[model samples]
Target: MAIAIAADELESLFDALPDVVFFVKDAAGRYTHANLTLVRRLGLKRREQVIGHGVAELFPAHMGGSYAAQDRRVLGGETIDDQLEVHIFPNRAPGWCLTRKHPLRVRGKVRGVVGISRDLGRPDARDPTYERLRRVIDHLQQHYADNVRMAKLAELAGVSLAQLERHFRNVFQITPQQALIRLRIEAAMHALGTEGSIADVGVACGFADQSAFARQFKATVGMTPSAYRRMTSTKE
Candidate 1:
């Protein structure tokens, strides 16, 4: 059954969260409703300014175009979950976030998209599972370039795969695999700033090959590795 709450209520509720950008987009991928955080990050003073605009209109050309493609996938009924992304918005801290988008359905028919991009927060160190997961996290940080295995992580956590997944999510807000990918991508991003070849950077970051690295890098960073290199170079 569809929830009875209205979109406006959801928008208002999300507005209290300054670290989350929340929105509802119509079938055409135009924003129908947005929270204050999203409006402000877009460099707008009012929600009305963001409404009726698509990502292609709100972000830079490259980033907006990539986001528009992602919207199309969600509008086609794909649910994007815990996708790590980099955001460089006006009047906001530049950092990585986890984004999720789900297709909104009405009467069993696809209607629109509802989503949120939340800034990555610190881990819950007070959680009982934190100590157990810390071992796994440390191993990843030390050997992110290696082909890390999930079974090894589960063993280190002293839990079954299912329990490890649950505990990791509770503490980190992302799956262990997602955590590993983030580590590798961050390493790659830093490596790209140097004089290293793009292929070498990909291999050094544990990706299977240059193509795989480029694909994942673009999806997460909203630009290709070469383009990212050029952007950084221009800023230098």
Candidate 2:
């Protein structure tokens, strides 16, 4: 079922979301609202410029127009959940957006279509080595809590460990263990800063013991988890 929200309320909620979000109406095919991140990404000086602007307005004159018609189809009670598209953004470099289109209903009736997108920009990934390393890195980034073995990483990268190590160092300039440690430390840091729990933070980042986590965290960030929390708290 479509989420029950008045247009204004939904706009506020959508704008509050951390991801870049915006919506378009079927009738006029203009932007209804764009979140702060989306606004900055589009390089608009002011919010007024974003609203009432269409993709054709923001993108270069040579961009595609088929999506506008597709948006209209979604508003007519068809749901286009997630579609991947590559387009050029403000810097004239290629970028990716995981585009989601859903029907926006008013009073249980289809009012318009709303689109949400998450950007994924990785130009270096076109190279073979980088792409292989990226697939491995993505698993670690997204599933840090899961047990990730060296064999699994090599398998995902479609190479042997020696090859993986050589290519990973060449592309990312970091060893696999270093990458894992950095990822674990960053996850711990985020958990420590945001949520107040020592053990939870330890386990979330695949750390078995608080002492080990504290040691590595201190080594990587020059501060313990508790100290990091204190730092963030002081800044707050």
Candidate 3:
């Protein structure tokens, strides 16, 4: 005999984890369940405030639109796994997270979506590859404005490409490629706060061009570079 757990029980279990945001959404993209971490991040005091709302109702316009679009893809049967993202916390601070979303199937039919966004934890210094990965990270930070190659990173770490990827995920909870992208994005975000043109910033951040930079920035930060700059300007 198999035991079935209730959604409420699962929600409660997830609520106990302070660093993870968990949710279930119906086919219409309305939230059916949300953990406390998500609620608090959205600046809500109670679960009821989040239970029936959609992303559009809870997040800023640009970010809400991006999240809703992602939900639509999931509703259409796409699975998003271990996607690196920058999530906005309650005080408008951005934090790194790895998000996963899957179509919830029931009785051979897709019913909804279930997802989790876990906060990126501190890297494990005890991992044997930590020192090697540290060197790679240092190089990324120092040279994010230049064209970066995974093969070069592998060589720097003195490991095969496969081992480098595995070690990065094991220690940092992200791939070496993701680490490089994170560095570039961080630099771009800082530069966006200046008066420099978006295109120039894109190229200076090691993106192939403006379009690629805008695409990656919007995909990870949930807004276009100009929109982000405007928002940040308004805040300042």
TM-score, every prediction: 0.91, 0.46, 0.97
> What are the Cα lDDT values of the candidates?
0.89, 0.67, 0.91
Candidate 3 C-alpha lDDT tens digits along 11-54: 89999999999999988888888899999999989999998789
Show the colliding residue pairs in model 3: none
Candidate 2 C-alpha lDDT tens digits along 102-145: 88676888766777876533335556788678888898898777
Q: Candidate 3: which stretches are off by over 4 Å? A: 1-5
For model 1, residues 78-122, the per-residue Cα lDDT tens digits are: 999888898867643357899999998988878899999999899
Q: Which residue pairs in candidate 1 collide?
A: none
> What does the lDDT read for residue 94 in candidate 2?
39
**Of the candidates shown, which would achieve the greatest lDDT relative to the real structure?**
3
Error at 42, model 2, angstroms: 34
